[model samples]
Target: MNKTPLNHWHREHGAKMIDFGGWEMPVSYEGILAEHHGVRQACGLFDICHMGEIEIKGAGAWEMIQSLTSNDVRRLADGQAQYSLLMNSDGYAIDDILVYRRSADHVLLCVNAANTEKDLAHLLAHARPDAQIIDLSADTALLALQGPASVDVLRRLGVELNSVPRFHTLDIAVAGVPVLFSRTGYTGEAGCELFFPAAHAVKVWELLLAAGADAHCRPIGLAARDTLRLEMGYVLYGHELSESITPLEAGLEWVIRWDAGDFLGKSHLQAQKQAGLGRQVVGLKLLEKGIPREGMNVVAADQPVGRVLSGTLSPMLQQGIATALIDRAVLSGASEFFVDIRGKMKKAQIIKPPFIQRG
Candidate 1:
């Protein structure tokens, strides 16, 4: 199995490791519940070096990126980033990625670990002959510090917390190592994602721990990360998003740029927009006691309407919550629904996310 640069550190810290996608990652450190509360109340540290990073350079870089991604690339000025999607001809998502515009001639694409190679190949296939593309996954290491007190923790580490706006990036040195610091995160918090040399992984990790001592920050794992994102209604790649699902069907039409000129799936997306969406992703809250899981049936009026894509017992809300892709007609017409848990049907209510607002 694949392992990140901080794998040994995770094991040393007594983390329960699990195989996520193909990488051996920590599922929990102290405990999932404890880690979840830590991030919500104080702050938490995460090793996210398993994600993939790709670089595009040269005069054609801007044009090449514009033609490949769903979001308006022209709107991204220097030192800014945008959450976008890489799409296929059928309008299905190849992968959801974050595009960082370092400059007109230099850009970076951060993609999911599972789809790294696939996304890279797709980009290379459509890139112009003059565009220079390079994969920097092996050389880059990323770390995330998140939660309500995240800014205070970073300020203790000598970072100018107020200057870097959300979705913006800066190049600076932390602990004497060059770092690419981006004010972005998955956990819906005021935090920063730091990218630095792979060789400096342990040093940076140790420094962050020492710096955040007074802030009461703890090391978090994948288990809590999953729950945190679910509470925020953020989409996960394999669950809320997939190769067979289009952005409109996933309720991500906001990211689709209709007036950005020609793109990979513009024609198909335009057609769908004109015809209207047949299905949609919706949030579900269980009215009765029961935990909702993936592949569970969603029923309306004693008949199947859709299947749960991602669900969990929200640690913050203390209730069962879920996201499902159901038929648009059924979802709009029905006021209430049910989730089939084992042989029992649990009552539920359709609601818009997010289940828990960030504190």
Candidate 2:
């Protein structure tokens, strides 16, 4: 199994480690509920070095990227980032990615850890000779500092991010180490994602924890991370998003640049749009006492309508919340559904997500 630079620290600190996509990652530190609530009420730090980064540089870099991704790369200015998707020819997602425009001729793609090699190969297979596509994952380390009091922690560390807008990047030095600091995060909070040299991982990790001590920030792990993102209705690669699911079906058509020129899967997506969506992803909150889990069947009028893609008992709501891919027709008129938990049907109500909205 693969190990991130912070693996030793996690083990030493008593984090319950588990295998996540072939990498040994921490599932939780103190506990999932504690970590989840900590981020909500105060702040939390996360070691995200397991994620992947790819650099596309030189002439035609923007053009190459634009042709490959669902979002409009041409719209991005330097130091800006856009949430986009790489689609296969069938208009289904290869992976959801963050496209960071470093310069006119250079772009950085932050990809999911599991799809690093697949995404790289997809880029290289269609590489333009003038555009250089390089994998930078092995050399980079990523850390996320998130939640309400995150800004206070950054200020204490001497990194004043008052001027850095969300979804934007700034090259800054923290604790004497240079980092590509971006006002971005997976958890729905005002936070930053810092990308720096692999060798500086431990230094940055320790510095963040020390600086954030007063803000009540603690190390969070994958379990809480999952619950946090799920609460925000964020799509996970294998769950809400997959090669078998199209962006339109996942309610992510907003990311598609219909006015922008041709891109991979554009034609197929256009056809799908014309035909209308047969299914859609929607949020569900259990009305009765029960927790929903993935692969559980969703029923409407006693017939299976869909299956739960991601589900958990929300720490804030104290109720079961989930995202499911169900028939679009059912959502249009149905106000309620049932998720088969074990052998019993649990009642649920359809709700638009960001289930627990933060100020």
Candidate 3:
């Protein structure tokens, strides 16, 4: 199994380690619920070094990325990042990535750890002779300190939060080590994702912890990470997204840039846009007692109409909630459906995504 640079620190801090994809990662430090609430009320830090970072350089980088992703990365100025998708010929999503345009000739793609090999292979297959692709996942260490109080926590590190706008970044020297601070995060709260030298990982981690002491921040794990993203309706690679699913089917049509011009999956996505997919992904908020589990059946009029993709006992809502790929035929015509949880049926309503948003 693969391990990030901070693996030793995680084990020493009493983290519950588990195999996530091909990597041995931390599931929780103190506990999942405690870490979840900590990020909600104060702040918390996450070690996201497991994510892959790929560099696209050379003069053709702009044209190369434009031909690959659904988002309009070319329009972005230097240092701007956009959330996008890498697709296959059928328009199915390979992975949802963040494209950072460092310059006209230099672009950075941050992809999921599990899909690093697949995504790199797919991109390299189509890369032009002038374009150069570099994999720097092993050398990068990513840290995230997030919450309403994150600004104050980072201020102690000499980064002014108010001046750092969203989707923007700055180079800073923290604890005498060079680091790049990006005002972005998976959590729908004000936060920054920091990338620094792998050699300085221990020092930066310790500094952030000591600075956030008054803010009551602590180390968070993958369990809380999953739950927090679910509450915000953020799509997980294997759960809400997959190789067979398109952006339109997943309610992510906004990310598709058909007006920009032809790209890899242009024709297929445009055809689906014009004709429409038979199924749609929607959020399910359980009204009755029971937690919805993945692969559970969604029934309408005593017949299975769809299947749950992701579900959980929502800590904030105090009820079970889920996201599912429901039959568009029934979803558009009906208001609610029953989830078969442990052989018992529970009622839930169909709603638009983003069940919880940050304040």
Q: For candidate 2, lDDT tens digit of each residue in 1-359?
A: 98999999999999999999999999999999999999999999999899999999999899999999999988889999999998778888899999999999999999999999999999999999889998999899999999989989999867666679889999989878899999999889889999999999999999899988999999999999999999999999989889887898888999999999999999999999999999989999999988999999999988899999999999999999999999988887766699999989999998889898876
Would you estimate the TM-scores of all the predictions? Answer: 0.98, 0.99, 0.98
Pairwise lDDT winner, candidates 1 and 3: 1
Cα deviation of 348, candidate 1, in Å? 1.1
Could you give the candidate ranking by lDDT, starting with the highest? 2, 1, 3
lDDT of 1 by residue, 1-359 (tens): 98988999999999999999899999999999999999989999998888999999999998988888889999998999999999887888899999999998999999998999999999889878778999999899999999878888888767776688889999889889999999999888778899899999989988888888888888999999999999899988888888877888888889998889888888998899899888888899998988899999999988899989999998988889999989889865877699999979999988888987764
Per-residue lDDT tens digits of candidate 3, residues 1-359? 99988899999999999999989999999988899888888999999989988999999998989988898876788878888998888888899998888888998888999999999999889989989999988888889888888988988888888797788888899978888888888777788888887788878988999999999989999988887888888898888889876788888888888877768878888888889788888899899989999999998888899889999887778778899988889965666699999889899988776777677
Q: Report model 1's TM-score to 2 decimal places.
A: 0.98
Angstrom error at residue 200, model 3: 1.8
Compared with the true structure, all predictions reach lDDT values of: 0.90, 0.93, 0.87
CA shift of 294, model 3, Å: 1.3
Worst lDDT window (10 residues) for model 1? 154-163
